[model samples]
Target chain A: MSDLLEARSVSRSFGGLHVTRDVNFKLTTGDRVALIGPNGAGKTTLVNLITGDIAPSEGQFFMGGDEITGLSIPDRVRRGLVRTFQTTRLFANLTVADNIALAIMQRKRITRRFFSSSTELPEVRAEWSEILSHLGLDRLAYRKVVELAYGQQRLIELAIGLALHPKVLLLDEPAAGVPHDEAPRILEAINRLPSDIAVLMIEHDMDLVFKFAKRVLVLAAGRLIFEGSPDQVTADHEVRRAYLGSYADARRPT
Target chain B: MSDIAVTHVPHKRNIPFAQEAAGALVILALGAIGWFLYPDDLAFLTRLIGIAFLVLSLDLVTGYCGVATLGHAAQFGVGAYAAGIACIRGVSDPVALLAVGLCAGTVMGLISGALITRFRGLPQLVLSIAVGQLIAGLANKLSWLTGGSDGLSGIEPGKVFGVFGFDMYSRTAFVFSLGVLVITFVVLQRFVRSPFGLMCRGIKDDDLRAKMIGVSIYPRLVVMYGVAGAVAGIGGALTAISTGVVGLDSVSFERSAEVLVMLVLGGAGHLWGALAGTVIFMIFEHIVAAANPFHWMTLVGLLLILIVVFAPRGLIEPVVLLWAKFKRKGSAV
Candidate 1:
């Protein structure tokens, strides 16, 4: 099967400090991959490269097949490559429905309208309602984003990403800062994501990562060191030595 | 940015057109009261209508889009000249003059907005002021066409539907202006609640998030600027129609700064706030200048300081809070 997204030998550096180096990956339809690493493993930089946030120093990215290196962020998003921020970036002063509705309206190409009310539009409400309720955020439809819990805001972020009709969604730490009790609901929401599209999630929580990802990619010092099933990832000696030493040691069959 | 209010779109939408309808009624009532109270000062009332247009236009970019602009008078002035010159060169129909002003204002808006939207924060403000100054300089330089600093004169409007004339008492001017302002308010009332306005508000809150959602922020800001220009241009045309002349002061730096003051004083985002600010500032300026010509500015300044101190969000925010509070209370009780 053709890859939905492919990054070829992507590498980026700042002066002498290398941020990403010779990273390569491909995602096919329905792939649920978790990218885990230490704090500066250039995980986000790789996602940025894929989403066209930052240009690669020496490699290229392709959506389906065509080169997307030259495309602007919006163009990339238009082609169904979308990303959520590590920190929740939402329209704080706007209501939850309006926030999700913005993406729906943009997708419908009705955002240029002047005569009809944006919130009153039935089509817009329908799209946002489905997306919000899919993540169980239908109750937050009228609540301002500011009044939402951090967990709810994170879900809203995912809702916004979903609203763009993404074929390949890049989620940067989907459950970061969420309370432990609320984090599972987020995991459930992530699990509830439409199964047809490919998802690459950057996460530090191994439990959530192990639970959510069918396949796993481990990065250490700017390069992907291991790519396999979650079981194999924990068994790999190099991944253990580079970053997952304690976790792997604890799980080892002595 | 712990308290980042970059995306602060204030009003919530629940009842659809009901809120806008009530706002329209309040404006109409206020305009009517102004008519009765200022029977002898209809000229001042007409001037109030003109400046209100500038404030409304400013609210679109600065309030909705969060695009800072200090030199908005570029569109306003260019529009005034377009209408005044059209009338002088014999485009005497009131509606036609307004169209000319609108076209000119839209062009100026597009040109300046295209450049201004490229920058953010302080640079955007600088660029806007630069554009405004550039247009004003061009007006001064093109002396034969614009009559330099002396102003453009001999503009004779051919009346509303060729029936009512602009008499010395300024009765027709005030009524005609009121009609135009009311219609503009209704249209804009619907407009701010439109998808375009909502999208712009989203862009205002966090443009990066907006981009991630497939929005092209630059073009949206420019188009809004063009819309603002159309309204401001009509305002300029009204000035030409009612006063029978357009002057350099119509597009002056002071006028731009004054409109900003008025918009900020009333509130930046809300449509009603724009109108209220213009009315309050203009009437206060007129009345205080007439009664206490020497220290009128002092009282105005004091009033402004009081408002800004007590209501940093603008005078309208408190009223909006009270109204929202009242509504919540009504629902509960």
Candidate 2:
């Protein structure tokens, strides 16, 4: 199967500290993977490199087998590589529906004629209704994003990424601050997403990671330490010593 | 960010159908009464309206589009010069004046917008200032045609479509300017309510996100700036035709800053905010100057600082917020 995204020997450094070193990774079609690491493991750097947020110091990255290491962030997104920030980046002043609507509107041309009457476009309006209804945000669609609860905000972020129509979605941290009950729902939503859309997420919650991700890759201090099933990841001595050391403590509600 | 929940107060009042009709009728009636009663002052009032229209254009760019411009007056000056030069060279037709002014303003705005777009932060502000200075200097250096500091005088604007008999009595001039001002206001109000305006607001809030979604910020901002410049150009042309003079003051930096203040004082995001700000500021200036010109500047400065600090949303927003607060207390939402 063709890899949806691939990064070969990608390395990045901030000054002398090697944030990411010789990090080779690939995401196959329909693959769900988790990038697990302790604090400052350079998981985000690897994601940034693959997503074209930052270029690798000495490596190649590809999307659908085309070199995209030099593409701008927007250009990369246009090629079906999109990402979400760990910190939710919502338009604070705009309503929830308007936020998603903006994403839809920008996907088309920007002529005065096209833009002048976009609000009434039949297709656009229908898509907006469908997206909002699916996310259970139809009631608060008109409310400003800042007024939404944290959980709702995260869902809105997910919806925004979905509206981009990306082939590969890179989620920085999907369950970072989600409540236990909410984490299951987020995982369920991810599992139920269309099979064509591949997801690669950086997560700290092993429970949620094991539940959703079919394949897992563990990073330790800027290097790939383990790449296997959830059971293999838990049994690996180095993975247990480094990442799962606090797994038992994290069992408590965050 | 805290929700001061109290009641469901609509953004506007829900008056009875009859009451809404009556309110519109009353306003029109009063306007008619004032129109005839103050015929002599109509010329001044009309000129004020034209100036207000220009400020409204600035409001659209700065307030709506979130573009900080310091060379807007240069665009206004380009319009005045285009119209004045056209008139002196025998194109005394109003339509010709408007066409030339609008085209000139739009061209200048697009050029300047393109030039300053690549620079952000302090560099962008500096580039805008430099653009204004360059245009003004060019006007001054091209002395023989522009008439330099003395300005283009002896501009005898012909009657509107050669029918109104635009003599020095100024009656036709006032009516013509007023008619143009009202039309411009209607057209601009529509423009703001359109999808383009909403996209401009979206860009203002977050240009990066807008671009990620596929809206290139640069091209849209340039087009908006050009439209606003074209509108402002009309106001400058009105000033020249009605008053029959164009001076260095037309392209002065102070003029640019004053229009910005007018937009800010009225309200940043509201359409009528610029209009209200222009009217209030002009009346205040006129009243203050009649008593003591120097003291009026100081008072205006102090008042602007107070407004910026106390009512950061401008005069209109504060009033709306206060009204909302009171209504919330009264309702049981």
lDDT of 2 by residue, B9-75 (tens): 1122333244334534543453455478877666666567667767877887788877787877888
TM-score of 1: 0.95
Q: Pick the candidate with the highest TM-score.
A: 1
Q: What is the TM-score of chain A alone in each candidate?
A: 0.96, 0.92
| Cα deviation of B279, candidate 1, in Å | 1.4
Cα lDDT over the full model 2: 0.76
Model 1 chain B poorest 10 in a row by lDDT: B1-10
Per-model TM values vs. the true structure: 0.95, 0.87
Candidate 1 chain A least-lDDT 10 residues: A131-140
Q: Residue B30: error of model 2 in Å?
A: 9.4
The lDDT of each candidate is 0.87, 0.76
